[model samples]
Target: MRCWCGKGNDTSVKTVGVCVRKDRVSPASSTGVLLNNAGFDYNVTRDRQSAIIMFCHQLNLSVMINANNPDDVLSGQNVTLDSRDIYLFSPYLVTNGRFSSLTDWQQKAVKCFNKTIELGIKVACQATSNSTIAATFNMTDLFSQAWYGTAMYNFDYFQATDIDLSGMTNVVYYFPNLNMNYGTTWQTPNVQTNALSTHYYRQTDTNTLHVFGDGLAYGNGTLTQP
Candidate 1:
């Protein structure tokens, strides 16, 4: 399930099946009546979580990180999260977790494909994909591709504990956004970028996925990007 976003390298982005009711496919769009796509209060955090879990069950799934490996949905571009990606103020989101310092940056986040039904493909194949589901995550959440679980700037910042790197290919890491101030102390770890067979990134318009450099979209023909 891939989409061609319009950007450098097409700046491809894959979105999730679950999303706010506003993005829902109205029943009027086709033959079926609107079911869960509307009348659900998705903006509420608690309802959002419960709705996701319920949708997951409907999709025949029970876990978030379904597997330990990346689906490699897009080109594994080496992204460096910097000031451009982060801001002093937070967005209007309720976070499940957070990483304030380097101590919490000594792990690896693997690939996950939890309820990632590509709506574009479904729409193309079928009339439309009514079984809607979507949820946004904080960058600090281990599940976020934006999360720097595996050191982003300095691998030596934290000591590794029981680790497993048995099955990984062409692993890439992110460079952190640094502020070389005169009297500021900054020590961040390298963030190992993991793959996600999801469209919840980079682009969101007309269901077109754009893939490209650093931020992630596509590579000439990466297994996932193509």
Candidate 2:
């Protein structure tokens, strides 16, 4: 396996060959001196198809390329490979599961996990005994609202007025509500009114310190409101 530093093989800089100058009588070929004087040299080589094949072999890697035409020759020498293009056959580091298609993998993996949870819940419900307790959890009030009340909800088919306090709870969220409801309440440290201090809040079941400003905490007995 390549070290985390990105070197193919962690080979020490041994004096492989001495560069002999015809004019120079004294041969100064010290490994430390050579390494110290080594100019800023990044692998500035654009590799063509053949060089890629050879490189893969040297690096103990397997790669595949379509070479039906005679024009398929190892060419260019750019040091870096395009992230978009993957070696068709070779399992390069980029294509090795994690970084490769991270979004797709994440979506699929989440779906798989959700499906597993659903299956587990279903199985638990079916095989429910006196000891087993099946519970359904929703993040309705636990999570923040998707849209800010100030924004308007519009689609291709239709467009409605700006988000109002019609379907929302009595408590005002981070966003402002345009249309006022009967039980419109504001949380502590309000932007406008300070008289209404008995605002509702939701606290995480596991933690009493972490409280969130919402109606669920006040309405559903999830949190203590002052």
Candidate 3:
């Protein structure tokens, strides 16, 4: 899937994540150059965000508009995470249990998988699972918070104040599509940003860390990077 690496000021760039939506896409930028330039072109430990920026730059990813789904983001990009990438889908998609809505046949990503069970099965089989469960746990944390916290409690009658993301752990969030004109129709909405960090001075892309202000992530102050 399409991945972005964002970390807190105190956190290092070890984990990568993705936000998924349903859509079709063809990447116009050079992924080869993105791979070539990422770690080599800049110091990931020092700048903390250069490689991610390069990824957005080369992939021509527009956080608000293009490639909104995990399937689309990963489409045609021959990359894999040693660890799994956390993918957050737009809440609107139906969970059909057929793998139809979540992923197309090309990628074959199903809705639920447990890294723990996977490891257990691998141990039982005496074979390497080649799979990691961090993504599933991370997704569970995300959905659990959003659901229990009533973040999207009343999807039809949404208010920015009702959404609470304070419970999230191990992942940083950026809601470029949080409001409607402030948000995109197929994107995130009404959910207030809890904490945001300076991962990239990026707009319309992920790995953008931090949330600011009256919890809605409003104003020019919210847009400032680092």
Instruction: Specify the highest-TM-score model's number.
Output: 3
Ranking by TM-score: 3, 1, 2
Report lDDT (Cα) of residue 50, candidate 3.
Answer: 34
Off by over 4 Å in 3: 1-67, 92-226
Give the alpha carbon lDDT tens digit for every residue of 91-190 in model 2: 1111111112222322322332233233221100000111211121112321111111111111001111112312333332232322222122333221
Write down the TM-score for model 3: 0.19
- Looking at candidate 2, the ten consecutive residues that score lowest on lDDT are 121-130
- RMSD to the true structure for each prediction, in A, is 21.3, 26.1, 20.0
- To one decimal, what is the Cα RMSD in angstroms of model 2 from the true structure? 26.1
Error at 206, model 3, angstroms: 40
On TM-score, the stronger of 2 and 3 is 3
- What does candidate 3's lDDT look like per residue over 157-226, in tens digits? 1111101222234332332233322212313322233333211122322222222222122211222222
